[model samples]
Target chain A: MTTATDKSAANSETTAGQWIRMYRQMVSVRLFEEQVNELYTRALMPGLAHLYIGEEAVAVGVCETLRADDYITSTHRGHGHCLAKGASPDRMFAELLGKEAGYCKGKGGSMHIADPATGNLGANAIVAGSVGIATGAALSAKRLGKDNVAVCFFGEGALGQGVLYEVMNVASLWKLPVIYVCENNLYTEYTHFSETTAGDIPARAAAFGLQAESVDGQDVRAVYATAGRLIDRARREGGPSFLVCNTYRYTGHHVGDINREYYRSKEEEKHWKTERDPLKLLADWLVAQGLADSTQFKRIQSEVEAEMKKAVEFAVAAPYPSVSEAGEDVYA
Target chain B: MLETLTRELTFGQAVREALAEEMRRDPRVCIFGEDVAEAGTPFKVLSGLVEEFGTERVLDTPISEAGFTGIAVGAAMTGLRPIVDIMFGDFITLTMDQMVNQAAKVHYMSGGAWKVPMVMRTTLGATRRSGAQHSQSLHAWFSHVPGLKVVMPSTPYDAKGLLKTAIRDENPVVFFEDKMMYTKLKGPVPTEEYTIPFGVADVKRVGRDITLVATSSMVQVALGAADLLEETGMSAEVVDPRTMWPLDEKTLIESAKKTSRVIVIDEGYERYGVTAEIAAVIAEGAFYNLDAPVKRMGAMHIPIPFSPPLEDATVPTEKSVFEVARKLCGQA
Candidate 1:
């Protein structure tokens, strides 16, 4: 249990401006995904994409605490992380369209999109692959004597991987400034977490003797408060921390899945989407605080839609990279 | 003044001097590995680096090959050049995801926006009977991955120059060194700085009867075989493909066409090895010009043994390479 002082400290750091930014980013991500899904269904886009609809708070809340130069290593479901870390949608969409204007010049597509200029080391297709990489980045930050920290975004499914344990032990042992964020979205592809994962992820982190916390991922404010304190502690004390965000994914594992009959029920999905919608929860809080009226919210929604539409148009009209460009990026 | 600086240096010492000098020359160059500090590295290849560069740059990781290697990749992505040493080449399999998926493909995947100017230095082949788990020549595994440059330098001069080149190149390179040659070899390394470009071959000895293409430690065996053949009235042209992945195929093809007979010597297993691929390419390109079959001399299809006799039997020796060439010459 967290002490009363720690809880109050977290509460004291919550600001209206911070809450507004989180809600806006979450809504923007939701709108962007909807547009991409439509494009994908219409065959206007090619290849696979792992959606992060229900896990918006994990990305937005955690990224809100990071500085611009702070690094992040992400998993396959990295669109939310990339956006939360400030990757523009135009290049991301262009990347999905396999155009020369794409983030990875059409080479990485969805699963491997990245912007090193913004400190994203690219999302990895391999499960649990970036966990250690993020720890390494934090190690570099610590070695360079900088207050910066690296965030490692993975899933509960990666808990069973051996390298995760190895990195946790070393990060803790060396006091590397890293934050291990496990976005527990209840499933790894088609398998349920309960069926595959043994023991609680938070408890596993505690066993490793690091500070561990579990946040209500549906509440963006709660996530932001918890992640902010941990990130601050990492920067100040020069060590590692672990937080497991209990969340869900609205879409299937990847794009183009027709049914949900194998593992999860449609009723359960609807329950999470309706009752635990992260965007709605944040919007409600913002409205209750009198931060903005409903008309203003509607205006924000329209602006987000326009931005996403522009991104889609740019992606659709962009040309694919020439064959000669294939060998160019192998070096600088 | 062109004063000659002749100093006896081991292959490992040459590597350390190169790293020290490069670190001093460029602030971006950093080193990381297990026991690379006071413990003096697994093979002592990084002896005294931590002292010279201090602990910040010459980092001593806690047996986290994947973590440190990935950290090096992340650092490289963020404008620093990192040289990571894996205690044994066999351990590279542990970090294949970072090396192959991230480090190798990051630049290409990022649409030329990012460059993984990183080097992974690992010792290869059985030398001190380190057993099956520690000794293996798996350079072919990395060769199969695109967007990566591979280098294997056998002599002190080549080790320093090639490593310097690898450090400066705007691409990820894997430097596979022979453990047996680390202390036994000596070469007149110049005091002034130098670099050898990639996609090029070095003609160690010129002859006309046949052409021998070798890499890493096999280059030494091929030279020994050449000497034995010379006394027997058979001249052989020897070519060392200093860099394996971006192979200097033009040089090999030209030499094979001139000699009209070809032989490949490799320390790795025979099946699907670099030798097999080179032979296939030559057979397709210069088949009509060949006066004899393209013979391949490589290790048997088995893991390296701890026993001296079995280890020697597994790898290709000078006598074995000579026998293969003799058979190709129809003199057996």
Candidate 2:
């Protein structure tokens, strides 16, 4: 919400090394999702996976500002969040494939994978499911004198949920160190967000006395700058912020079986993919700044693709969890 | 074992003492809910906690069950062991997504990698005339979940001891305190700290004719019924399975086998309720030992009415339980 200091604009004040690392994470998530898409199409992965193809910048930008012990609550489309929060693709892919070596030991599959060691509290399938969790984590940080901050990621669809407002009310009232990032992808399932949502989202958050702002999610630098300011402010006990990121999804809500064309024309989808793809936008920005050349970007892309390939191989070769383990995790 | 002196304490005082003691014993323990801090919640069960623990620990939350319940889960997932005072049991329906879905499934879905060591403290039962919205014994709904532990304490002693154990447990626990008994139920609670482990049922009365398995507010009702049966030259055993989910099936089934007749009493509605579950466990485990079929008694299927007389009729009275027991024992 603090727009006065746009340090990350053009990757300002951030080192070239940090920029490259961020770029690498975004690229890795993009290609890893591509591999996921291939596996889903080939029926190699069971159940459905929500792809984070076009929304990579939001995760990378925000997570770059977080400490390793800081927490985040995610959404159904959470691959980008996990990867950006430092969950290795091998375990993530293993989770998606229901492998024994997966982050969740395959129990959580894709939509529910959790890697607590990496500060990814876990992903939730229910919309706005973890808003309270993020707030509670912030409450813990404040009460326990911990320096950790908790960031919650949901969609514009979550704005309709009353719990979001409830948690926001307490969070702002208590000045808890939490960040609510709403990735407004313009779509909630097959419907446009506007069809089900009312008025403005940031304005609604502002009504809760929150420091709310809107950002272009396709621009990694803008997202990074805004999220960095907000997260830093949160770490300093500056209360919570509601950040609305205007973004889009390149694929259907879930993998396979759903005809997204029935809801919106392919032309509308093409507009976002061809013009506003987050990864493409960041890559283009890096090339323009001379931070990374096309050949170097291509090299990075190949390296990420190879990394994703290895991840898939590990997942495919990993064993399934034993049936004996099914009854074990029900309690402590 | 430490020899501890027992002091008379009301259920309300016992619960407050448990919270204060737990918070004092463990820095990780904190409590939050509507009207909990400044107003001491509706029942005053958290009275004086804010003064002792400060608002930083004994926080008052905005009225949002879904929001704060989720926060408790999140805080529990991190470092803090939170006790969420949900105010009323009926309102827990507002938090089903968090309780039934997230908190209940986190540890399991996370493949035992994470533990949600939190307790949801709420008031249950219908005799308070607080209307259907505020009056309900909804413990049965929570006991149905897998990862969640549900406990309903009928006595001050049980309330204090079980709460300490619940707070120390490395899992989510839904603790139900009887609303009507908060001020009226008094017992000799040990002044020293003690914890009653889950899955341990206490035999309040010994008998040979019939085993009466009771829960929450119904425990007293079953005891009253036992007294009435005793006057009629029929002895009845009363068993209180303190924790409903990690139910002490061994004690219950063994008692049922010894008596050769059993009756399950719950304040919740009968059809597919806690009674059904207990009866199923007995039928499946100790069917051959039964001389008579297991009988179940619970509140009527209709929502608890606002009228005192109607509400009294909905929940099982001592007379109703005695009648059911007499019928089960062929003494009617």
Candidate 3:
């Protein structure tokens, strides 16, 4: 088992194109979340918004290794996972705005956005709720002789849930093709994780005989390298692995939760935002390596900003689902 | 009617036959749960399944109900149709978040993009001295959810037919089998294949004086009560709404209108149980034709005890149902 501070293996084989694409994806998620916070502040979005602003690298790096047909189950703070898994921004904004053109046709809203075309099982609102679904998908892949692997993305808060341990044990025993990705963003909604979680996190998976590893979540290359190794092993019948990504949440638990002095301090948030930001770290590496310049980074940001602006406009102009449709999809 | 050979089969055998036949027809169908493979689930309901389907399909998982149940949801959204075998209904509390928050809401929340074609098979009823932890008829809990279908079978024939439909359905269905009736109850099951559609009521016995609307284990008790009422120079109709969520409201209302009185019975708790929902539906649909207020019979509000006498006293019996029917008909 690897510790939280353990550095990931070397990523010398990754080409410039893949690195730039990963950078663009992370930037897309950040811009999308910035727009979501804008929607919430303007009272355009109906439900709560749990933005994935600071933890973009974990989703982008891990999902970058997956094929379009591979399955994934996400958590409540899941816009980043959805986008990284290939969900369209226009439809996602429509869903958050409770419009008929949304991913869930306005039924699921922020906490639940699922798409079969992209093999997203759906973003679950309950903590650690989708662990079993990801494991089951792996079981289906194995039994059906398909080489697809499933990725389950959850927060450290899910460690408090007993089902996570149960599934991890069974996944190890059955040798299912799945990965348990725990994004330890430190705070589990108003309290530090240490106050709630006891014992070592990686040791929990190791006890179940799973291949447990940890990586610096702010480093997209580290996340991509570690997740790629585990996912490939799983596809080749290596069973499940638990990957703990040490990340941070730059925003409050939700958009409405603005006060932060009660749980965390301004210095802590400032240090992570300025020094350890995922986008800034990746950009610095790209610049030093002579692979990209400041001009290319600026172009990427402007492109993403334009795309997000259009998506929000489409969502605001889209119609709400008719009252008759409220009872339509309840059965099949 | 099509000519088909019929033979008496126990409830357990019928359920096993349904699983075996479905797994054979669809290569994607599989079963997983604690002691499901070789142990055949303590009751020996699935004894020969592992031998036929092999261990790959008939998997034996850890005692992690929530974990495996969540996996079933994910697998169902993908390519495979999974049957999750929960040992007892009392343990459903562990899997509620996976079922309610994940499985039940996935399809509708995804805007009908994904389907959870899965079945959760578990046991209900008491009187085996299994104590409070092992005995419970909690089908009503699943039925209360919008996106889940709840099935309760009384006879071997109904069990086989309904279980087949549940496995083939394109949504999450909770199939509750009365454990006490596994071997004790026998009925003629057809050798040829067939499926009983949801939301259709079965008229177990036809009468004109009063109606006894029952579900699952209570259906058998209702039949016995109808027999007693026949001896007392009264006619009591018995109607079984096999699936509770997609309830046969039209059939139940028709029966209530014809009989002018009704007594709803189930094996779940009396307060806020299946009986209450069915009674409400009948009252709303047949208010003008009814002669008396609808009565409900179910398990006592306390936990089922370990003692045989106390356990038996908690649930409704043939005598109690008969007395209630008699009183409703103004003959008490």
Candidate 4:
């Protein structure tokens, strides 16, 4: 377990430029999700989207530690991970808008964007769906003599899935280079995770003899530092690790889930938003270190907002794939 | 056809030979499943593979079907050509999400950018008295999915040749071997390397009065029926549409048209199964030419019973198929 003080110490080693970059990336995810929500409200987007508003730190922090060639399998709430892994916002928006210019040529909507260039294997819609894919990629890396590590990103909801434990066991047994990143974002959809999960979460992986750790998901630096250690260990043939990032969701499960008061208290949402916002925490830390000011933060926000606007415009104007394309890509 | 310099091999030996040949041909090929390594599976079909490729390439996983199967999808997407063994066809219920949602849709959902070059090999047959939990012919479930290719090889020659093609193909392929045929069935296989292309039906016997289209275990049953038909002064043509997805519709229709009658046979349940699909194809394509409606035969729609007599009654036997063929040919 890592405490707040240890998290701060871990942040000390990250370069100023990388910290700034991380800040920008987190902001990008936040704004991108905002656009997605707006698109949903305006009825421009076709499907449901699980927004990653409050959990930016987990995706951004862990992804920031990865290389462009490293593989990542994402969840339905995966916009943050895709962007952090270097997926272009334009193609991402295009995919969400069902445009031909999207990463998956609009075949995969908000929940299924996959970009090979960024080694984003794909965002899966199924709960705990990509656990096996991520582990398999680690196996591939080990067998092919590659130093690349794969990150399997899932929510605490995935802990209910048997496949996660199964792959973790295989990964440990084989010493495959992979990390299982569990972002415990308080709620599993509309229900609190406590209602579903049993026993200790980290102990589950530890039972398989995996290196398990828990860190604050709101602390980007802590996630980055811990993920870096595990990933580096995996690359050096140290096998798999399980990381539990304690975090919260700022919005309802999906854009349509407006009556969330039935499941969670509004006060809980407000507290996380106001007191434990990852962006605010990081921005304050940057200011305390004299690396950034209010003006710089404002500038970063504006830049990200503008970039998101352009991406939305591009996706809105992009053509839908031809009808004949429905029959294509099913085989090869 | 290649020169007939062939040696006889059991169905199990043929499948092992295919895996061995593919592993020798490609360094990226690897095997993962329960007891696939030292135990060589309970069937012992994979006995010599671990000795040849070492444990690094041939891995034995825990009894987690979904976990390792899911891993195979990710490994295939990245760099490895993985062949996951699902000890029994009945256990495929555990891997539906991985094979259906992940492996099958990855290529199309990624708009052709990602490919899952993986093979899931499982046994499909009844009457071993392993009861309902161990015995099933569930290949039809995979055949129903668009992006998955389903292969069911009846002969040792077909098993070796088609498995090689499946390993090399750029899409996810499910190969079902009849467990009953693994030891009991033997046929001539060529020493020289050869691969049988999917969607090409092989005519096991040429006749005229009626066409019997069969898959996997049912092919041998159809051939046996054909012999009985010949003894009864009826000429029966037996065609094997080795692959269910890339179906040899042309050959099936041609045979149906030539014979003017058809009976589609498979070991899967009759309702919404492989037989239904093939019968539908013949009904639609060769309706005008067919003298009689295309008949379908498959396992009875019930959990395979444990008793020998009851279990034997579930699947179509040679006598049953012969009776159906005789009736269809207007001889009964």
Q: Candidate 3 local accuracy as lDDT?
A: 0.91
TM-score of 3: 0.96
For each candidate, report its DockQ versus the true two-chain complex.
0.58, 0.84, 0.82, 0.91
What lDDT tens digits, residue by residue, belong to model 3 across residues B211-306?
999888889899999899999999999999998978989999999999999999999999999889999999999999999999999999999999
True contacts kept of 4: 0.94
State residue B211's C-alpha deviation in candidate 3, in Å.
1.1
Name the regions of candidate 4 deviating beyond 4 angstroms. Answer: A1-10, B1-4
- Candidate 3's C-alpha runs over 4 A off are A1-10, B1-3
- Residues B1-332, candidate 2, lDDT per residue (tens digit)? 86789889999999989899989989899888888997998788888999999988888887788888998999898889999988888989999999988999999888888889999998788878788788877788888889899998989999999999999999999999888888898899988767888989999999999999999899999999999999999999999999887988899999988999999999988998999999999998899999888988888998889999988888888898888888888888
What is candidate 1's lDDT per residue for A1-332, written digit by digit as tens? 22322433554655666577677799878887887788788987888867888889889888877777888888888888999999999998998888999988898898888887778877888888887668767766776677778899999889878878878877787787888999999989988999989877788877777789999988878887888788888888647889999999999998776587789999999999999999888888778879766787787788889999999898899999999987777767
Lowest summed lDDT across 10 adjacent residues in model 4 chain A is found at A1-10
Predicted complex 3: CAPRI docking category: high
Give the CAPRI rating of model 4.
high
Model no. 3, DockQ: 0.82
Question: A1-332, model 3: which lDDT tens digit per residue?
Answer: 22211212327667787789989999999999999999999999987999999999999998888888789999999999999999999999999999999999999999999887788888988898888889888988887888888999999999999999888888898899999999999999999999999999999999999999999999999999999889888888989999999999999999998999999999999999999999999999999999999999999999999999999999999999999998888778
Q: After superposition, how far is residue A322 of candidate 4 from its true place, in Å?
A: 0.8
| Tens-place lDDT digits, model 4, residues A140-233 | 8888888888999999999988888888888998898999999999889878888998889999999999999999999888888888888778
How big is the positional error of residue B136 in model 3, measured in Å on the Cα after superposition? 1.9
